[model samples]
Target: MRVWISGGGGFVGSNIVRAAVDGGHDVLTTAHTFVPPPDAAYAVSKVDMTNGADVRASIDSFDPDLVVHCAIMNDWDRMYADRQASWNAYVNATRHTAQAAIEGVDASYVLVSTDWVFDGTQGGADELTPPNPINLYGTLKLASEMVALEAGGAVARVSGVNGQHLARPSTPRAQDRGFGYFVASIVDSLSANEPFTVWEADDINMVATPSLALECGEIMLAIGEKHGTGVFHCCGADAVTRRDLAELTCDVFDLDADLLDFGPPDPASMLAAPVPYDTSLTTPRTDRILGRTATPVRTLIERFREQYAAQVGEPS
Candidate 1:
């Protein structure tokens, strides 16, 4: 199967590209600003999702069997301030891509979504979880999902996505980037003999990149191939708190857990939307369809250590 991905050079899309390529499928990836991943046997093109004409042109030219749309502008900080970033990143871009898919592209589409749509009232939620977004980021993403549904697109709503790529020095991540990066920060702080703080109040059922891609690829391929699989949830092994997550990484990387500061999440420092206290998703329908549970957090963190350590030239 031939696949095309937006945000192909990013954290998740790159993993999807690698997995697809390794599985003996043809892939075409695109990046808006970042230099596209080095030209591999599979093609990586430059695409600007902000421009509908360009997105349409790229889809028409690729003519892929599957297209995974992962280009989201998730500036969560600006979401509640009436900022247009989310609208531009999700709403407009998705509507444009939906038109391209239904009228121009030949591939089946997968729209990656988020767990934030639930407003943190429930845990172990599934695709049937009613969406009541408390912030613009989730709200716009929900709009984007609705837009893509016009084309019968497959939806993969994700919560936390961890694991980092080889540090190109170009891809700088922040503490709030994802849980894995936060773990990385804790490691770095310890390495530097500095102190770091962590929130101890939530549980996570997050999906890392490759596992997410596989489940997404499987379901969307089914959807695109006329198998009639509708919406699905792509989640991880089990839920863990930030405190436990920190301790796990520390033990794995052999860092001093003593330097860590665990406390309740500082409300004032938190983002506008309430983070899910228990953000766990159960996708039995997804599992029945895909035939497997997504990867466990323990194994994922070990892989992260290996990958990140290698990037830092440390013997793993």
Candidate 2:
């Protein structure tokens, strides 16, 4: 299969690129600013998603059998600070991709979505759950998903994705970037015996990046193969509080649990957005269609530890 991915240099899309390559598919990837390190295995191109002509030209040129749209302007702080840029990245870019899929080729299109599309009132939200996004990012993603559906595409909504990647820098940032980065940074800090904080009230069902990518790739491939489109939720089987996740990371890494402090989440934090308290997703559709089961949190954390060790050249 010929597969093309947008934002393939990013944290999530990079994982999808690796997964697709491992699955023996011909892969093409696009990067806006951060060009991924060159790999002989897949083709890379620079694409500005905000430009309809750029997106259309790229997709039309690739003419892929499957196109997984994972691009986004995902920095929470920047999304709020520069709302127009965020809109262009998420809403306008998605519209361009959808049009390319609809007008250009018979490619199976898959739009990566988030559990943030929900408003947090319903825990374990399913494919049938209506999206009521509470924040600008979520709202734009939902709108993108609508564009995808109109273009005869499927939406794969995933939870917080965590795993180590070669693209991630060794130094920890002052603010949390995303769940995966947050977990890795916490482990790195705890390993250095540095104090770290976790919110007791914040909750999410975190999925391993490779897991989400594998399932999402297979689901997207199946969608292309069958010429079908709909929504699929691929998330962890269980939800955990930030506190519990931190404690579990400590346990898995044999770090000092004493250095971890628990606290309430501050909405004013740099990582702040309209995060749902409990956006755990149920994946009956994924199970029925892809024969996938929800991965356990412990299992995912263990995978994370192994990957981290590999990336850092340390013992697991």
Candidate 3:
């Protein structure tokens, strides 16, 4: 398969790039400002997705059989702070990708979205649940989903992507962070005997980057093969609190879980917009479509340990 991923320099996209190349697919990926270290396996384009012409030209040049639109300004504060930029990147850029895919012969477009699309009023939302976004980020992503679906593309809603980005720098940069950073940061803090804190009140469904990337790759491949498209819930099998996840990480890494401090989430104080408390997604229908079950959260965290070890060159 010839695959193209926007924002491949970022965490989730980097994982997708790694999975695609490891699976023996020809891949082309893009970055806006922070270019990822070179990989012989795939080509990287310096495409700013917020620009329509740039998006179209890049996709046209790649001419991929599968296009995964992963580009977005995901920082909640930034999205709320600069709503226009976020809209351009998340909504306009998505429109460009979907337009390119719709025009490109035999190409399938997949828009990577978030569980934030739902307001989290009810736990365990499924693919059939209506999106009730609460913040700017969620609103834009939901709009992107509509654009993609309207253009006859696929939407894969994911949550809390955590794992190592293989193509990133060995010495971590500020932007080289993901949900996996939570585990990595805690490990580092524990190593230095520094204090660490985990949220006590919130719950989220966290998907390991490797598994999410693989599932997304498979979904894109299936869409290309069958020329089909729709929304799919791709997330971990279970929901866990920050405290539980932190404890599990400490246990997996042989750190002192007793040193961890618990704190309640105050979205109003910490975020520029309202955030979901429990955006757990259930993927039974998606599993049925893909003919596979999601990896358990504990198992995925262990896999994260392996990737984290590789990133830091430490024993797992």
- Per-model TM-score versus the true fold: 0.83, 0.87, 0.87
| lDDT digits (tens) for residues 1-316 of candidate 2 | 8888898777678777877888888998887776566554789889998999999999999888888888888677788888889889888887888778766877888888888888777777888889898778779899888888887888888676666543445434332423545567677777777888765543432322223344444555665566558898766676765566777778887888898886654445544454555666787787777766777777777877776787775432
User: What digit string (tens of lDDT, one per residue) describes model 1 on residues 1-316?
Assistant: 7787787666666666666776777888777766653546678777888789888888888887777788877456665555676677788888766667666765677777777676666666777777777557667878888887777777777656555542145455445523535666676777777767776544322322222333344445544455333567765666666677778778878777888886655455466454545556667777677666666767766776776686674422
Which runs in model 1 stand beyond 4 Å of their true positions? 37-41, 77-85, 166-170, 177-180, 201-228, 264-269, 314-316
Relative to the true structure, how large is the alpha-carbon lDDT of every model?
Answer: 0.65, 0.72, 0.72
lDDT agreement of model 2 with the native: 0.72
Candidate 3 ranges with C-alpha deviation above 4 Å: 75-78, 170-180, 201-228, 265-269
- lDDT-better candidate, 1 vs 3: 3
lDDT (Cα, tens digit) per residue for candidate 3, span 5-55: 888877778777877887788899887776655435788888888888887
lDDT leaderboard ranking = 2, 3, 1
Query: What is model 1's C-alpha RMSD?
Result: 3.7
Q: How much is 260 displaced in model 1, in angstroms?
A: 1.6
How many steric overlaps does candidate 2 have? 0
For every candidate in turn, the CA RMSD to the true structure comes to 3.7, 3.2, 3.5
